[model samples]
Target: MQREPLVLESAAGPHTIINSKEVVNFASANYLGFIGHEQLLNSCTSALEKYGVGSCGPRGFYGTIDVHLDCEARIAKFLGTPDSILYSYGLSTMFSAIPCFSKKGDIIVVDEGVHWGIQNGLYLSRSTVVYFKHNDMESLQNTLEKITSENKRIKKVRRYIVAEAVYQNSGQIAPLDEIIKLKEKYRFRVLLDESNSFGVLGSSGRGLTEYCGVPVEKVDLITASMGHALATEGGFCTGSARFIDHQRLSSSGYVFSASLPPYLASAAITAIDVLEKNPDLISKLKENIAKLWTGLSDIQGLSIASTPESPIVYLRLETSTGSVKDDLKLLEDIADHALKEDSVFVVVSKRSTLDKCRLPIGIRLFVSAAHSESDLLKACESLKRAAKIVLVNHI
Candidate 1:
């Protein structure tokens, strides 16, 4: 049987109206709580009044507006990269970017727990793609050694290591420092997806590279979605001037799709401005994470899967039902009860069977800087109660 999806009547933030009822939202990816920000709203409104609603043509044709270019330049400056390219949609960035650099006969060694976007990119690349155990340096080294041995007997091919800075599927931070070391040893270029890490990690919110103390030059390519922390639509890729220029010409999504709305582009620029002016937001976010972690740590039958520093918190069942589908159903039940009984909303992440992710299914609770102490406490209490009720017999 099919069920209708819940309809949200308001903007997604720490609290939202779902099915005409207010609930503390834990499912939104608005990490820094930029949604409904007054300055951002005003910036977007100004752009809308000036530029109308949409850019009807692709970037190469007639859609290259000043706001689009401004947003790209602002992102490049913020990330300390030479240049950047913007895409109209977030998922399109990964699928288009991977194929732009790596084609057939190239090699891509990726983490097993990467999200569907990165997985789709690998599929489109048509490259020799291999998956290492998620976040395991030893497993990555073993895979690298095997691939190196195999490539020794063949003609030279370009090699890339693709991973997410903060994994969407597992909520785990990739060890960028160690990954960079391994990349140097294996002569592999790094393509990092900072979708979740862009505005949530790092002291200044530059991303995992900054958080890990890795130089920006060490990363070959970096891609991220503005939808999360920036609280805006579209995505961006930053790298050397040559690499970004190549994408502008060759990336299918960038060259063919309509450019991002001028207002959203303007909002992105304003979002970066907000980050620059208020570093305290990032610290407040860290404090919220610590508070939420402490609240949820002692829950029964559920264990925390993410780290202390990660804003994305995952709660996994202590034991599975021996069936992936059934295990996910239990998690779904917990989410439902949490919302119904406690007015707390959360999400259970379940991958499509067609996908090849190796991470275990779990409930994903996104913590934002906007969430008050009461919101975090309520979610934890609700989840603990729901989990106990749902997993009572199994536990």
Candidate 2:
């Protein structure tokens, strides 16, 4: 059966107001405008017409299509790893991997502010859990040293370190280089969820490993969400042939869930090619990020969250809830002036909890290869205006 397309009425480079009867949305993960790219559209359309809508069974079953296999193989090469496996979603690949290799007495060392997927996985795993400070290498090393110092008692059990290349919320990147160094010293396995970094970093866009000049061959495990950077649906886990083999055999998410759609696989591969051909888009994205960072720093009103080197940049909105409920509306109001009134577009981050109002939190300014210098300046201008309107008038 074919899937229903959510027609947007229209879309251009990076700005799609989604003015359909459907909904105006900022909840999208299409960071680089990959979905509307003609290359991806044509390739995925061809695959859909050729392969149908969805896989009928799991990959281990009768669901392995030639296109799917090719996509998986090519992803490994693209990421500089020997092997890769696809999952229906990124969180599934990441969460399921943690528990697959660990068991009781084994310890899962995690960053305190890791994505909820890691936190939840540790809760479900039989392994004892240890959480160090977010992106604090010394904290990670201290935890490792404390555990391994009692080597004889801990000999039967093992430890694994898990973190993301870029945090989804605050956009702060993890210190993988130092973590890798600690792995060598402490004998801990590492899993890096490259969800927020892939297709948005490095010359080849292989993610943080490449950005940091680390060899993928040395990293034991890697996982990523395709939805964001790839402008497609699904996720993937990549590593050595042996590790992938074990994951395929052991990961429940891979075994039980329906495999990713063939069209998505085809589109993802083509999307990677587009990224490779246009290295400058990646560079431009960085420029936008840098501009946003610099602009925010110069502003005396707001506090930028942990400075981001990636596409997702956030700041701490200093207004109270009495000032605004669902900052999305304030952002939407700003977007109207920016997009509607002034013909500019920006995605304003939303706040779900009450404490989120002034709890050292703020907006996530997303930039893509599709945005222009004028667009970024416009967004910054709008953000500053909105912040003042809400903060000064205490709206």
Candidate 3:
């Protein structure tokens, strides 16, 4: 049987109306609660009035506006990088950026747990792709050694190590410090995706490189999205001036797609400005994460799969309820029960088997800075209750 998707007629926040029912929202990516922020709203409104809605053509064909350049420069400054190139859509950033540098003859060693975007990019790159175990430094070392040893005679080939600073599949932070050490040891260029970490990690929200104390120069190419914590609708790649220049001309997404809407560029710029002025927002988010982690500490029939500092909290089955299909159904039922009985909206990770991911399925509960202590407690309590009811037979 097929089910109709619920319609949301309200803005996504800590609380929202779904199917005309008010629910505590745990399915959104508004990590810093900037989705409905007043300053961001005001900035977008002002830009809309001044620049109107959309850019009519591709960035290469008279679509590059001042706001687009401003936003890219602002992001570069915030991250302390030499330059950045913007894309209208978030996923396109990876799909385009990968092929921009890596091509048919080169090699890209990536984590197996990377999201669909990276997978698609790998396909498009036509490169010799190698997969390492998820965040396993030893596995990465072995893969690099094997590849390097096999290709030692191929002087013309290029090599790259690609990974996400914070993995979307498992909600785990990549040990970037170790990855960098391996990159240096193997002489492979590092291409990092900070999509989930940017504007959420680090003291100043400069992403995992900053949080891990890895110098920006160590990374050859870095890509991220402004749609999450930045509360904007575009993506960016920040690195050396040479890298940015190459992407401007060679990256298909940036060269062929219409530039980001000017209002969104304004919103992204304002988001960075706000982050600069109020460092406490990150601190507040940290506090909220700690509170939520502590509250969910004792839930039965479930285990927490994310770190306490991670804004994304994943609740996995303590044991398989049955087969894979049956387990997936149980997880989704828990989410549905949370929504129907307790008015708490949550999500279960559902992916096509074709994706080749090894991560476990779980109920994904996204925590935000906007969530109050009461909201955290409500969600935790509801999740616990729902898990108990749904898994009673399995237990």
Candidate 4:
């Protein structure tokens, strides 16, 4: 029997209404608890009254508003970058920004576990793409060395190393310090995607560079989706003035797509304000992450795959079922049982047909600052029970 998709009847937050019942939400990436913030709402309302929703044209063609420039400047200042360019949509940022710099003859060494947006960008760029083992610094070093030794035109061809701050599929944090060391040694420009890390990591919410104690200027480019932590509807790329200026004229998404709604741009600016004023929100989020991680430490037949610092708590099976479909079914059953029987909303890591992720399937729990200790406890107990019921039956 086919199952109906669960409909959210309320705003996505620590607790959400679904099927007429409120459930502890572990599926949303509202990491800083910014979704539906009062201040953000007010800002959006003000911008809406002034600008009325859409920008009505591409950024190049009268769609650029004061709020857009303000939002871009705000992001750049927050990240300590020289400049930034904003995109109408979060997912479009990766696909557009990547191909803008890399071209057919360039070489891009990428992590295999990056999201589909990056994969599509690499495909579109028509660059000679090489894959390194996900988050394996040694493998990346080896790949770079191999490329340098084999290609006589290595110095002539543009070289780039692309990786995510926090992998979406695995929830593992990349070793940015090590990656920086390697990029310098190999003479490759670094392009980091902080979609899941921005406003979530670091004491001040400056993302991976701050978390790793590396200077932000060391990385050539950084891209992030504001939807996760900002609770807004767009994305931005931050870098040197040269990179931002080049993208302004050539990036397909920025050049052709309609500008981000003025209200959303305002919301993003207000979100940054909220983040800066309340640094304690990041600390609170870390506390919740620790509580959830400790609670889920001893589940049977599964192991936590995410790092202790990551807001995303991923639980993968200790052993695969010898088939991807079977493993996914087990995970789905566990998630469904948790929702139906325990009233805790969780999600299975289901991959698209186009996704080439080789990582193990798992159940992902997105922890939030808004989650109370009781919420974490309830989710832990419910998932433990669900995993036992589902895994025991499957065996």
Candidate 5:
């Protein structure tokens, strides 16, 4: 039987109220624990009072608020990019930014493990899309070589290599250093989605480029959703000033959609300020992730799929049940048992029907700086018990 969607009765954080019971939350991507942060709340309130609730028009019209420009500039400065453009919605950032520069007859080499937002963007670009093996630099090189050799007009048409810094589906960090070398060798522009890694990976929370020690200018385009690390509602694309200027005029989402609310923009700006002031937040988050990984090391019939540096700790069955549906069901049962019986909230990798990626299904536990060692221990113990109960019968 299909279960009804779980409803939250309180604000999402390290702990949340669900069905009148408080549980340790591992379902949200609140990496910095900024959901109800006092500073961000105060910023939102001040902006709300000053600018009202809405922008009332698209950015091209009278909707370009001062806070939006400040947020964009702040992001550019944070990432060391020449400029950046903001979008009202997070998911739309990928779809709009991808198709903005890539048009028909262009070539795009992408990772198969990228999220649905990027998949949709590639489809909309009308470009010839090619998929390399997920995170396999050798496969990327081979694919790029094949494309270069096979297509005689490749030099004439625009070519882009798109990937996610930390894949949402598998929680794997991309080999960005190797990717940058390949892009330079093949003369391809790189469009990286840093939604999952922006504030989580780097030493100073500047995303993949900083994490990999690659200069910010190495990437041609970089986009990230503030929803993940910043705990804000919109997204931004950062790169050269010329590229941003072009996106302002051509990107569908930025050109046609309403400007992001002033409060959200203010919240994003404040989030950055908070992140910069307190670099220790990243350290605390890393420590929490380490504690969770250590606790989950012995989970029965399951294995960790995420990298040590990743906040998204993905748990997959040690052996597949041979069917995606069956595997998903088992994972869901474990998640449900952990939530209902043990008061630990977790989630399965529930893919959209529209998503055509071939990655395996698993359970994803989003770790946060706010999660205490005790909270992680509780989650680990609960998951272990739930997994044994769910998998024993199947075995």
Candidate 6:
């Protein structure tokens, strides 16, 4: 199928122009409303004028700058990790970070639904990959036991466990603490992708490791797209000093690719500063999530995901036989009606073969601290309209 061009122009927080009409944006990754913050913009602009565009070369060359050190230091301290490394894209961190520890024949037990980055990276590593039921500890343990009992040749191969802190499409959280408890018995390294939880989870604003009371050392690696909650460009991996030091020389993703530029790094540094200064931001963010969750709870035909301590929400649509479909007829029907009539924009899954797509009725909504009570009320109103549109039209 051929596609038509869809233009987007942002006017205000989480709202944008679609084909020239301004509509509320429900599909953005900007969780904390930092994209357009005056201070952040000012910071980035100043750095841009000072540093110019782009890093100009990979960090291995002359591109490494004071701003890079500034941001990484602040992030390391903020997340309670000793060091952090930046990447041009969040997905790059996934490939470079996870493969740093593993080699051929190593066993990796990954959550069935981790974002494709880790899956693809692990595949490239040629490590033996095992899929455990999503967030199911028993299943994961079974797999770990099987790998652990193997011969000495296989025993030399290490095991790593990977999962998201808050699943994006489902708005659910992983059982991080439960998974961590099993690490000791299984001797498996744990990796967390905190794209949705960092800057939002802990009472102190650390990521999932902090939120779960797990020390920073417990996690072998922490990688995420700062583009999400951190509201910065690129991705980062945080861990012990030696781990990052090793990656500096070994991780090709960082060594070959351009380093994060001074301007964006400066902005991220400022964003963390803002988060640290305003602990109330996290408190208010949770309240926003609670309000939305409470509003959506009583709806019929809605199967809510496990409430991870994050602010994303998903509404799974039912099929005639209650299954998945990427055609997303039901999703299109709901979104078209909601946009034209109620002005809501929710995401529908596009990948079909992976079974990630739900019944055409599935939709993803991103809640933000930028939203107000009245804004949430409008969102709920849009959902109610959406419910009627998908159900009544029966598309």
Question: Clashes per prediction?
Answer: 0, 2, 0, 0, 0, 1
Provide the overall lDDT of each model, using Cα atoms, as 2-decimal numbers.
0.92, 0.74, 0.89, 0.93, 0.94, 0.77
Residue-level lDDT of model 3, residues 1-395, one tens digit each, is 23555677799899999888899998988888999899999999999999899989889999999999999999899888999999999988998999999999999999998988899999999999999998899999999999999989999898999999878887888888999999999999999999889988899888898899999989999999888898789899999999999998899999889989999999999999998998888998889888888888789888988867777887788887557788888898888899999999988888865576778888887778888888989998998899889888556
For residues 48-157, could you state the per-residue lDDT of candidate 2 as single tens digits? 89999998999899988898889899898787788888888777877788888887888888877666676657766878888787677888889999888866565778
lDDT of candidate 3 vs native?
0.89
In candidate 1, how many Å is residue 147 off? 1.2
Question: Over the full model, what C-alpha lDDT does candidate 5 score relative to the true structure?
Answer: 0.94
Instruction: Write down the TM-score for model 4.
Output: 0.99
lDDT by residue (tens digit), candidate 6, 190-258? 888888888878886787877788887988888888887767788888999988898888887898988
Task: For candidate 5, write residues 1-395 as lDDT tens digits.
Answer: 37788999999999999989999999999999999999999999999999999999999999998889899999999999999999999999999999999999999999999999999999999999999998999999999999888886546899999999999999899989999999999889999999999998899999999899999999999999989999889899999999999999999999999999999999999999999999999999999999999989889999999898898999999999899989989999999999989899999988878998978989999999999988999999999999999999889
| Overall local distance difference test of candidate 1 | 0.92
For candidate 1, write residues 288-339 as lDDT tens digits: 9999999999998899999789989998988888899789888988999999
lDDT of 4 by residue, 1-395 (tens): 34566899999998999999999999999999998799999999999999998989999999999999999999999989999999999999999999999999999999998989999999999999999998999999999999988886556788999999999999999999999999999889999999999999999999999999999999999999989999998899999999999999999999999999999999999999999999999999999999999999999988999999998999999999999999989999999999999899999888778887778889999889999999999999999999899999988
Q: After superposition, how far is residue 143 of candidate 3 from its true place, in Å?
A: 0.6
Candidate 4 lDDT for residue 210: 97
Off by over 4 Å in 3: none
Error of 5 at 362 (Å): 0.5
CA deviation > 4 Å runs, candidate 6: 1-6, 151-153, 306-308, 318-323, 352-361
What is candidate 1's TM-score against the reference? 0.98
Residue ranges of candidate 4 with Cα displaced over 4 Å: 1-3
Q: Record all residue pairs in model 5 with backbone atoms less than 3 Å apart, i.e. clashing.
A: none
lDDT of 5 at 323: 92
